[model samples]
Target: MKLPCLSIIVLAHLLLGPLSVNALGATLDSSVTSLHHGSCDINNGETNCTNIIPSPAKLHSGHSSHGMPILNMTDLEPQQRLFWEQYDTTTYWSIANDHKVMLYLHTFSLIISVMALYPISIMLSITKSPFYIPVLTTHLIVMLFSLLAFFIYEPSTPAYLYPNNAYTKMSIILFFVTIVHYVAAIVKSLSEWVIAAGTHDIVFDDDNSDTIHSISSAHDDLDIDNLEPVTGQPFETKYQNQLMANIMANKWVNSTVCSFGYLSTLVFSLFNPLLFIYHVIFVFTGVAWSFRIGMGNQVFNVLAHFIKGGVFFLFGLLTWARFIGAWADKGWAWNLNPNDETQSDEEDIGNDYEGTKIKINKKLTMEFIECFLIFFYGSTNIFMEHMANTNGAWSVKDLQHASIAFMFLGGGLAGLLCESQVVSRFLPNKKHAISFNPFGAFVIFWTGILMSQHEQEIPTSTIIHSQWGNLLATAAVFRLFTYTLLYLKPPTNAEPTRPFTEAIVSFCLIAGGLVFIQSNTETVLGMVYRGIDGMFTLNVTVGATALLMSWQFVVFAIKGWSERS
Candidate 1:
């Protein structure tokens, strides 16, 4: 049953052929001469140079002094080969800047990473964590660098891998979709948090109760429903005090943006039905589940926030949504029941640092499905890449299908295992189950690293840069070491080692960014200034920002510890 050596060789050739084709696209060796046979033809660098007389066209004693070799035209196969052989590389369409496309894709990917941070930021802010602003700002800056990277690099992706027009359009549209969603979410959350904290003086329009500013506080006793309009007090201009009011006054801005998003989704769905549908599903589900984890309240209120808040934007839409929904649910108010004697329940007053009581219901089931889908989508691509390295055990296309199926299973497991009851079985404390919430991100990050390592056909130097897996793997080992150190220490109320553990997370992230910047430094810097990697170059920009952010997080934790001491 042994296959012939020729058959095996043919199979290998077919399988490895694409990698070779991709290699043909490596950075051009500028030192090489562009002329064919050191002679110019009448076409002067046309793709097809028909009359290719030997270089110098020196006569060799023959009937035809020109000595031009002619091939028989009767054989169609050979004719095609001759036609291709005459083609000159000089006329090939090239990217304005070779690494521009890579920069664009990388930037957009970083933006997506930033989008992922909103949920965590919202959670921390609600609980009034001191690190809220810093954490959120770090992610925002990371996203900014991502966007800058693309433009700085000028997104000149290899044309063969991606059709310029289609890829460009898709990337731009997707970036906006994510941007709008985050902005809306932020607005809604900010407004809600403001009213909840009761740190601001809310202003209201006298005649139009609904039109007056701000939302119901998380404390149910506030009785926003019965608030009386203030008659004649100067409106305070302190940013925090009137934050909600200002946002609520311009509710239509977010509404218009969301409406536009809906329209765009509808239109794009026509051409890219699967992509459009998947993205919508991801956003909807991601918001719902993340809201549940971050905000922690009744289903109805979450829905209201989602509606009022821009579907996804920075915190803006979220601020607006919460403000508008509160205003609509309960008109203009000035702390109606500030005198209530009863203590506020956890549900009524959201707790930032602790978990909220979540009911297991149909909505919860949907959320689980959504979480799985998002993870599955991210992992499938990387999984297929590794599977492709198996030497004909599976075709790339088939491996893609297999990856999807496997992700479906893995995602479901992730959803199930994340449940409190399920996690409590293995962990020392049930309360810490929520900490595993970031497991999805961990999975996605590693998948990205693996994809880069398995990626085929790039130049050796490029591959070295792309292989951030090595860095990440080392980080993982270090993380395990930190966790062991934390475990050995006696459990205390403050969890003294908490800061050090968090530093590990920051370190891993910084390491990932460092490797990425290192690998793409040349191409990224080339886009801005020829050859030189300046102090403010792409890699330097990304690396510096990452280092500063991680350092801030680490220092914040250490500072907190010192203050306590």
Candidate 2:
């Protein structure tokens, strides 16, 4: 009975607690309602009584919640309203300024022109053909035009005026380099004229009648296998003496007017070999400068796109060059066994001799270079990504990118170790000329997947990322295919295989790099505001890449034709 009573009391309190509280609250609410009704009633018609009732306070004039100004378009002047309208809806137009457009066109034209000229000049120079000087002159003229355009039309914007900016410094350096090159070209031409006059004078000289006869006699009497017993002179002494006599007899060679010309010619001739390299750098710098101006404040983003995209772009080009036998002399034309040679009769004669076989230095192949570059890029990118953070603290985004760098570092390091001689000794196929390392391809594939899945706040950016990501992934896949097919039917000779899959790989990489650059935030926004979609941008990238590849093939063809001639 006692336990039941205790349980009953607890159940009553739990069931009626809310009802009892509600009853008391309702009584208080009625009393307050009655008091309010007495103070303000429609029957009394008392306006003062209504004012006594409490109410919420209204917002202050010209201000909204959180003390923000309430912008009223009607209150703004015509000019101010127009400015606001343009600012809100015309961001894209403002960003794509006239100066940027001019720079873009200039850079594009300059790059295309240089691309065609660089290979042509190289071929002409190597063959010492009659057209070499003219082609080189044309190249210099083009550079001069580009420099003039840059100096004359480049906007004097604050960003470009910044003294410490990299692009500004590059422009300054380019100015000096172009001037020096122009002067060198002038000196070289003058020197050539002097040398030509001297040669013409020496060749047609009738006074030196015995010169030709003596040279012919000495040349005919010279025996390569026998030396002069009494004179004990070098084999070419007679020829050298005759040649010197003819040179000294020439008035042009002996004149003081031609001395400086000859010296200048000799000095400039040393740099002539590096002209192609200089031209390439000149064009690339202009392009980079244009990119910097167009991208605005995102320096790191610009660098990321420029460097990574440039590497892949170059990789594709090199692959294509390799396919066309650019480096066949170095045994780097994808040959399986470049060092293996057929046993000739002379070699066979020494086969039984243990010490007869000569060992040659190991050749550095393309795959090894790829692995080394991948490692180097990864190692440096680790610090680079961290340093990109302005606050010196790693955010989630920084870590995310840094993780990719780590992956590259590991993959590249492993490839290097495997390709190393010490590590190769433990492998089964140690004697193979190529190590057949797939880590580089694998790293590219992983990066593609990660980039493809990378989320961006803007839908346009996301789509662009996916476009390049797919291309990169496709390129990696085809690269792997190339490796597999080559391994199965390895080419024995040091000739370009020109595998079909390699072409696909080249196209993919080139296209992927181009698309990667287009995915920049500002670029995407500009395109978006101009009603350009991802598909249009992708099509443009593809078309440009194809055009570039076609141009590259033409360059290689010209090189091949020159070599044959």
Residue-by-residue lDDT tens digits, candidate 1, 1-565:
0111122222222211221111122112211112133232324323333433211111221111121221222222221223324422220112256554654455344434433454345445444444444565665566556555654553343444322322334445655654554454455445444444463333344444555544333443322323323544223313333443444434464344324544543443342223323343344333222112112112222232233122111111222222222111121111112122323234332222244332111113222443565555546444433332224355553574456445545764675566445564787542320122434444434544554555322233234335444544444454455435433432222112232443444444444433343333122212211112222223343354344444334434443443343
Q: For each candidate, C-alpha RMSD in Å?
A: 18.6, 21.8
* Candidate 2 segments exceeding 4 Å error: 1-109, 126-128, 155-165, 175-297, 336-361
- Write the residue-wise lDDT of candidate 2 on 410-467 in tens digits: 9999888867877756775424334477988988898888998886544566788998
Candidate 2: residue 329 lDDT (0-100): 62
lDDT (C-alpha) at residue 200 in model 1: 38
Instruction: Tell me the TM-score of each prediction against the true structure.
Output: 0.36, 0.64
Q: Candidate 2 at residue 485, lDDT?
A: 79
- Model 2, 116: alpha-carbon shift in Å? 1.7
lDDT of 2: 0.54
TM-score of 1: 0.36
The runs of at least 3 residues in candidate 1 whose Cα sits more than 4 Å from the true structure, single-residue gaps closed, are 1-466, 494-504, 513-542, 545-565
Candidate 1 lDDT at 479 equals 44
